[model samples]
Target: MKATILVAEDDRNLRRVLRAMLVREGYDVAEAPDGEAASAWLAERRADALITDIRMPKMDGLALFRHVRERHPDVPVIFITAYGTIGDAVEAIRSGAFDYISKPFDEAELLRVVGNAVRTSAVSVREGAGGEETGGWFGMVGCSPAWREIRKVIEKAAASPLSVMIMGETGTGKELVARAIHGISRRGKGPFIKINGAAIPPALWEAEVFGYEKGAFTGAVTSKPGRFELADEGTFFLDEIGDVPLSMQAKLLRVLQDRAFERVGGVKTLTADVRFICASNRDLRKETGKGRFREDLYYRVNGIPVHLPSLRARREDILPLADYFLARSCAEMGIAGRKLSRETAEILERYPWPGNIRELENAVGRAVALSEGEEITPPDLCIALADTEEEEATPEEMRFHESVRDHKRAIILRAIRKSGGSKTKAAEMLGLQPTYLSRLIRILKVEG
Candidate 1:
């Protein structure tokens, strides 16, 4: 089947040039004078790929790219921009544009990029038709046996009404797994409320979890519903469950056991048909032994424990995950047609992702941002796998002496400085929830 390519360029001559080139290459070509028209065309017809200019009349390339990503994940995109910068190219790739070409680009180069994009689009369609679930079940993507086994367990767990405990290293996608189970369960239509257990400070734990009555405490101007109440007949994902305070754990336990909870200052008791799914990077057993985590709560949440595999443990899945991340990152950034070079793939597969999936995702995003060309390289990733080759370089004693708190302080300060005092940007750089970063900043006493 001939691939259909949509060309959106305000420049009439360039649009003709692109359309002519693609049509001559045996592709069914569609042209729109601007992004708005292109987006309209996209709404009706299925285009294998999109070729758009960075600048357009009503809508720009970035905006169009976002539209395509949200509506058409299967169609690959190629961007053509005269004002291309390293930053622009990086942004394009990170946004999920299939590829970017500078103005006055060689016809050969354009053809090559388009060919690749078309091929990718075809592959996506084929996979979707083959029932591969490229987006995976509920946006989780993995093909490894480990992942399959985990999915089977999640499937079984989803069938029941039992509480589930997810165990994994930070960034191993524990919440994603929880969501997958929720999405497949009987309560799929219900709200999936996620709360970071650590983000809620000690004083606000009750107000946040159980909510408060009007004028219950200082600044409690109105009655508010808690996460549990909001997640009625849904799934409540308590992330970083290990960080939940011992006192709060008992309250959570009561809700789990009785399926009933009371507002902070309300006399009336509320009932919720909510499912509990807890996740923790820390070993709850160790926390229980240390008298940090409640034993009863631990036993209750661990009704059907599911473990997520780290990237290093599932090495065979690294490349696939990398590709998925790359695609997602680019799509989100409104850039498309970016690809990993063979060498980059090797670097990613060989690196032991200590930070696991989260780390790998950050690495891929960094690579896409840093890489200038169509292909991402090792240097583009900017990942220093020191432990990979020099595991013994740092002495255990020296490592042990390093203060984690001090190290974290330094890192936070660096991110703050680099982002020019923007907490939002710093949070993005650190891959942290902005609220969580704000809490850390206050707790760590970071100066503005």
Candidate 2:
């Protein structure tokens, strides 16, 4: 099928030029004089890709891009940028546009980017048709098997009425997983209340979880509902559940058992049909064994256990996640799209991310801030590899690692291609176990 490329440029001459370029590349071209026309065109027809100018008369490209993102997320949007609107274009890319090319762009470069956008759009459509969720499922960007399994668990847990307990290392996106469950569940439209068990003081735990009556304490100015009451018929996410004070565990267990609780100093008991979602970085089972956490409460909250793997275990997702973070940092800082240098990508993939996804995000954000040019290098990352008990690699060592990675990646790509994109067949061809081959592919970042 011929891919349709929509050209939305205000300038007629430029639109003609874009149309001609796309048509010559064998793409079916559609032209819109401005963003509004493009929006109207999209309302009735489907385009595989969109190329829009930043500044248009009615509904600017930024607004149009947002419209398309909400209405047609799979359609890749590219920006036709000028020197003056380069910042806006970068912001668009950060907001999830496919790509951008500055004015007076090389015809070849424009065609190459458009071709990529069209191919990506095709894949997205295929995945959507196949009932497979995209990488941006609930704002979690990952394609590794571990990530896919976590998502499956989330779907099952969200469908059930039982409480969900998410266990993971710190910075492994436990809260994010919790939120995803709530966001897709039957109670999705309801409020999602959250509290950190470790953040609240022991003395304030009851008031925070079960609220306080007027005149209950010295600072009680008025009656107020707590998180549980606030989250009635909704989901209450208790973060760091293992950190809940021992004294308060019994009260929590009672609430979980009965779904009824009394405000401080109040005789009347209130009931809330709230679903519970808890997360803990600490091992609650061990805590229970040590008598630090209540045994019954642990079982109550652990109705469904969802474990998020550390970032290092899902090496294939590193570069994709880095790109996600880079886009986010660029948007937050209002900077142009900055890429990771080849050497920097090698370093990121090799580093033992002790802090997990959060650490990687911070590293990317720091690099974005420290980077002066368009590329983020090792120095820009400023990561302390020595902290992982390994000396930082010299330039020669880094180059050697890159060379090895590239060679392995090439060989794996060849095997997969020869096997017609079957990893199992590819493993057979390579004379390696399928699981081990999958690991190597992930470690080498061979799959997009």
Candidate 3:
């Protein structure tokens, strides 16, 4: 698929030259006279790739780059540098610029690097969203070891009535864990009520959970069932449970222990039969220690902890999850599923996803909305994630090791190709002292 690149360069002549070169390579080019114009353009429409000059007027490239890092963190930016300012070029890269090229680089190099950058960014954005729990039981998107362990935990949790506490980052799908727990529990046939702890008012929290009778307050018209009563004989998922206000924690603690509550205006107590499942993005232990959360309440709700791994923690699931989101999002957006190129998939694997799954879903949706072709190419993804809001990939990039293995294999094949199946010549050509190549070649199981 052809990519749309937003180009920002102060020099009109240089911009013309670059735009022409990119157009020839079959890319959709957007031109901006300066950084300010480029920023406005990005705000107006998400560009697939961004190319800007470092020394442009009215928002230099660096300043623009920082802005992108803040506003559109996913959009990857490249700095165009003259040959002498190699130091500045290097600095651009150091400061999170994808890559910079010397002024004299031919159109081929420009196209290749720009194409790579576009592909890398696009994939990152799409896969980054895979960390979310969009995929539940029927939606669980992977077969990774981490996910497999999670499944086992869910199965065990499902068979019992023990309260569950799920912990993970924002997009990691803590609620999905709650659902899985409900699906497996004996009360799986019953209603599953989900309430966001952070979404409720502190004052209304008790009433929301325990119900209130008529005249409970000025606005109370009649008695109403609370979430606990509604979820009786079933599961109740409390999301962002750590956000529960301190003043209300004591009352909540008592309800958990007593497994019953009396309506706000009624003296009669009502019993609850709901299976409690709590989800939190914070460390409950830390919160408990900090005196912000009740220690007794923590243990009560954490009878069985279901830990959801972050997207980055389960790298093997990235592409599969990305493809799933791609198809789902495309369908929702009234488009076709865009195919992923092998190279683009590799780029997805290379980056660390700090935002986890939710970020990935949003990126995929954004890509689908902005898709310009049948396939979701690397460039398409890059535009979605370029700029700054760049999610941090795991510090230990797995792809580097994968690349090393790939490069080593390529070198062996090249030596043999250059030697015309002559092991001795290949060994000598490869600079191996003697029969070392033969031994190495055998170990590698070279086809030739």
Clashes of each: 20, 0, 29
Which has the greatest TM-score?
1
Model 2 lDDT tens row, 294-380: 989998999999988898999999999999989877975789999999999998999888878867876787668556799987766
In order of appearance, the predictions have TM-scores of 0.60, 0.59, 0.57
Q: Mind giving the per-residue lDDT tens digits that candidate 1 earns over 1-448? A: 4778999999999888888888888999999998899999987678988998887889988889888877786677778866435346435553345556666676765775677567656544432111112375666667889988988999999998989998887667776688788878999877776656765566667876787786686545446566677777788888778878887889888999998888988999999889999888789999999999899998999999998778788887888878887997787566766999887787788778887876776778766654568898655663223223345446774563244344456667777888898888777666565887888778657664
TM-score of 2: 0.59
Index of the highest-lDDT prediction? 2
Q: Which portions of model 1 show Cα errors greater than 4 Å? A: 1-134, 383-448
How far residue 389's Cα lies from its native spot in candidate 2, in Å, is: 2.2
Which one wins by lDDT: 1 or 3?
1
Q: What is the per-residue lDDT of model 3 for residues 1-448, given as tens digits with 9 covering 90 to 100?
A: 3568999998899989998999988889999998899988987666767898888888988888878865665576777877566567555543445556557555654775576567656543442232113343635777799999998998998887788998888778676677777766788777676656765667677776777786687545445556676777778777778888998888778878887788778899889877889988799999999998999999999999988898888999998888888887776456766777776688677767677776666656655654567776554454234233335645465564444445445566766677797766655444343466566557545564
Candidate 2: minimum summed lDDT over ten consecutive residues — where? 125-134
